[model samples]
Target: MGLTQTGTYNTRQLQIVIINSILVVLSITAVSLRVWARRLQGLGLFVEDYLSIFALALSLGVNALLFQSLHAGVGEHVDTLSTATVEAYSLNLYVMQLFWNTCLPVIKLSIVLFYQRIFPVRSMIIACRSVMLFLAAWYIAFQTTAIFQCIPIHHEWQKKTTQGKCIAFVPFVTTLAATNLCTDVLLLILPTRQVWKLQIPWGRKVGLSAIFTLGIIVCAISIVRLENLIAISNSDITWSDTYSHLWTAIESSLGVVVSCLPSLMPIVRLVKSRGSRRDGKSLTGIGQGSSYPSYVRGPYELSEVSNRVSTGPTRTRLRAGSSHSDLIRKQAGDIEIITEIDQTVESTNHSNNI
Candidate 1:
């Protein structure tokens, strides 16, 4: 193993610290936004929020464990470290691997749960539930594999101690990376069809698609991380794996941040609303001259509510003197609700007409 040193600090170690530090800040910011959105909506911090917080906490554990590994000489040349220190580094790395596996799925589960609350379509709900189940199974499998991957477990950290054989590290890492990429792609595509099918205009659809596409950033990161993992030589354990370790930290940290963004809709709306007022123009929903409605349902609920009203034999009465814009706004609170109000109102009214 070779070490990169620069002026009193190990370059690899410094890189890990810098990357994980940024991740910690982002993770905290993302979780805070998620919680603030709940408070803004008066949802009072539901289960999904708790799940996200727990995931962030676990991510912090991973970050801390990585730091511990570095302290024990993980980023230095293996020859420079004592056998005992190397063994300690091995143990820290093992714990970090477990936490990394655990944290990713937990954060993903939180995202799925958030989707469930926002998208009420029966099919979408079923899909989200299915994803949740798969994630739960994945979580169990990950922890089990991490725990039992090596014979007699302790040999995982004490590789030189016994003749205990263990799963090949390269294959294990490659497989883990592949599986993570698959899930990332799944999550990235899961919301696209729903987003495109939204009753909003094509421009808005494109804009929204772009937002969901941020998941692609995480996906790209995963791919690079996987490539690094595959390229790492087993000979230089600590030195060669530094890039993989850095990307893993980045991948999980960004996962938490990206998953929490959609939930921050309320905060975004509040900020946009305030900004628009100062410019002498109110934020429009879906179309020209359309003002926001009072009902203020989030984007995720728009389709389900619209579907229910259109399918039912129930006529909707516009609140007295409520204009077309108001009705459109009533169905969804997001700025994109600038859709045609008369059409929506008539359909809703016809559904309810006796």
Candidate 2:
């Protein structure tokens, strides 16, 4: 089709889309590989994480679709669109605006859901839920505003004629942008305090907390996104470049992933911990694999248990098999028996349900 002043479909947009598509696939793939790395043992986590990853993938798909529609519909316009192009223009704006706005928030919500398993504490979970509620409110407000942003959702052609009747695009977008950035920063800040309260060593706390504090990443990316939005407001219609769209996609995607990365620590550790368990000789979750968490030692029994358990190549039982009772006695033999203890330790931190 021939191009017109409304805009011409440019190769730059396509390139941005292609790169973003690649990123979407790669991100999802990495998460999927981790979830199903060992199919038999880890499949329980598959459903939840697949949804998590799917949201990310879907957001990317929405971006790509909208990217194509905006270019094709707008670029093909002739001088000015007529009754025929009205539907096309309307559809383009509606789809593009909805995709860019809604899909991103959906992805972010998915991340928050995945985190439920990570922070099992009642208070922490409550905090996460509250933040999610706020995100939902923001999403609703933006979507409602977007739907009403244009007059009749089909009257951009005569848009200037009814100037006083409709909301200006700049004010609407700028308000949305400011609120979004604030929410982004708020969501990012919410988790750092929880990370700070972990009982881990200070260095580990800092390092591990950094992973959860990816609000920093969100903050940084939001700054970049703010820049991009400004550029987009004055973007060249005749030219298409991947840089602007690709970066905006990053701004949106990164927030979801940043919120998500914390929840993944348990997954990564579960994989690694399971590997160590297998190599150390555990074929069942309730077997030695489960025993590891409770297998603490005081001086002599540490050596005794270490000596008794052999991860040999052959499935041969050399030492006299010790019962759980015998194991306790052994633990008590060389040191004061840890009898007076109230304990509430779950199996394997089992937060991720692994």
Candidate 3:
């Protein structure tokens, strides 16, 4: 059955659909760039990357359910919808909740896995694994609870039936949101100590820490979503739930986007490096038959030049310098800032020895 219209039949369903549609597109783009960045560095796709892809897939599923719910009159007043329309909306929402619960924890796990990849210290790795295990348990428990929340699961959508008992929705949802918020905060703090211990410049250390903690934005969105969920009323639930769904869409899509921000850094640096190379080439007339060899432009070029002209100890020094440069480029490209820092320290020691 189609949505019924009353004298006061205003609906925000279109707004929800439009906002989520845009967010889904953005999330897709972010994940694509993350994959591209890895490929640019010649790195293989890691567990975190695969997990991100999975999370994005689940989020897409949730968005599809959301659109279906909206089409079934999810943003109209309950009284304006026929019983069948309301049932359809409720069924869609029920399925959406399961997807939502699954998608969010996967996003967090992906982030945690990324941390484990970047920081290989014994304590840090242990902490990451512990968090990952906890998240797995959390996801399983919540998904199971969501599936069987009502004594007869069909009663969740077939609200007119009074035979089956259901758990209190608000309390269940509030507890889930609260635990999710706690995990967000934990993940935000997990890497801070390690970041501070980096041997890089204090400014760079702070910048790196900030990048790792970008999940704070997701945490803030989670808080807002929890508040919105709490304020939603059962009366006119179809209309009231629209705002809740809007926040859910924003939170899930933004989580994927934020998780991807660090990986996108390599692309930014690659673009900037290309622009710098172009400017240098123009200023020096390097490609226009200048006296200097074309291979004198940068570290990679210098390494090639040195290989042909240098000898003995000079050759050793040149090769060492070239290796250092290569190491930095590869580490930066890989988005392995921690390894980059360690290599920076080792490169400094090697320079002093030479």
Candidate 4:
């Protein structure tokens, strides 16, 4: 059998590959279905969630594809691949190469842009803009480090001795990882303090909190994946060495999922309301349409209540002076509500990726 080579992935690698493929499918489906469900419920096609979902699709796919390539040289063919631990670690570095070069920085940037929706106050706006600048600077520095880490780039996977030509990796990736983790925590945390001030219900506050919790989830991914870096600090290979790849899968996948969760609220509320309508007719019917309809509209108009009347067949007499409230609510609802009806932005990010 000659000297058995370490790089051939064997069944274990295949299994992990399959598992990663499942995550890729789940992440894509969750985001896509969530998007579709929004359209179904009239939540409109939002770019915020869809962009991350699509980016995850690319990042995860590249991770999977590139890892499988490294696995190709495993078995008795020792010379075809580098040392086992090094190959796996480098696979991570390369997967990161794909992500940093193409995806993560972009995802983080778009996420900051989406923040403007929930935060329109001047200072919050400026802070969020600064976050965008931070994201851009990080991306530029990150890709530079990743590119220089492996000489000729092809040597990353091709088994060539990088010899003096490539930049030593520890400083580069660890800095990248630390910076990434820090920013993930910041992006997730910054908006939340501002979100707390919203007059939305406690449950809504909790929901916003849950959405921001994704930042913590991202933090965990960073921390846990750091273990992989430590494992590879000397470029050692083993199933343990690759656990970080699994963490990477999780971290990026969940970021996309959590990013989209807030957008799904309206979809969920819309569905439940429909389900309730199906189960039984309403006594007051005030809560009949999407959400309390009162809550779905903005706080400014619906913030207070007063006498109002409905001239239509229902003859529903609302609080009188609340007409101004209803007018503003109806108008605001008119524009925002239609966002749920339009369904075409879905593929736009795919183009962005291309």
- The models' CA-based lDDT, in order, is 0.69, 0.48, 0.71, 0.54
By lDDT, is 1 or 4 better?
Answer: 1
Best by TM-score: 3
Scored by Cα lDDT, where does model 3 land? 0.71
Worst 10 residues of 1 by lDDT: 303-312
lDDT of 1: 0.69
Q: lDDT by residue for model 3 over 75-123, one digit each (tens)?
A: 7778978788888887888888898899899999888888876777899
Q: In model 2, where do residues sit more than 4 Å from their true spots?
A: 1-11, 14-18, 37-54, 66-93, 156-166, 233-244, 266-354
Candidate with more favorable, higher lDDT: 2 or 3: 3
* Ranked by TM-score, top first: 3, 1, 4, 2
C-alpha TM-score for every candidate = 0.79, 0.62, 0.80, 0.68
Q: Estimate, for each residue in 168-219, the C-alpha lDDT of model 2 and write its tens digit.
A: 6545655666677776666666656766675555886677556656667767
1-354 per-residue lDDT for model 4 (tens digits): 112356344664565567677767766766776666555433455565566666776667655653554343322133344465445545655765566445666567657766775566788889988988888787777777676556676676545444436665555666677888888888877878766776556886786677667667778878887767666534233343455555666666666665656555545655554454343321111221233222222211222222122221111222212211121111111112111110111222221110
| TM-score for candidate 1, residues paired by index | 0.79
Candidate 1, residue 182: Cα displacement in angstroms equals: 0.4
Residue 340, candidate 4: alpha-carbon lDDT: 17
lDDT computed for candidate 2: 0.48
Candidate 4, TM-score vs. the true structure? 0.68
Clashes of 2: 2
Q: Could you tell which candidate, 1 or 2, scores higher by TM-score?
A: 1
Clashing pairs in 2: 7-75, 12-240
Estimate, for each residue in 29-61, the C-alpha lDDT of model 1 and write its tens digit: 999987876665444676778988998988888
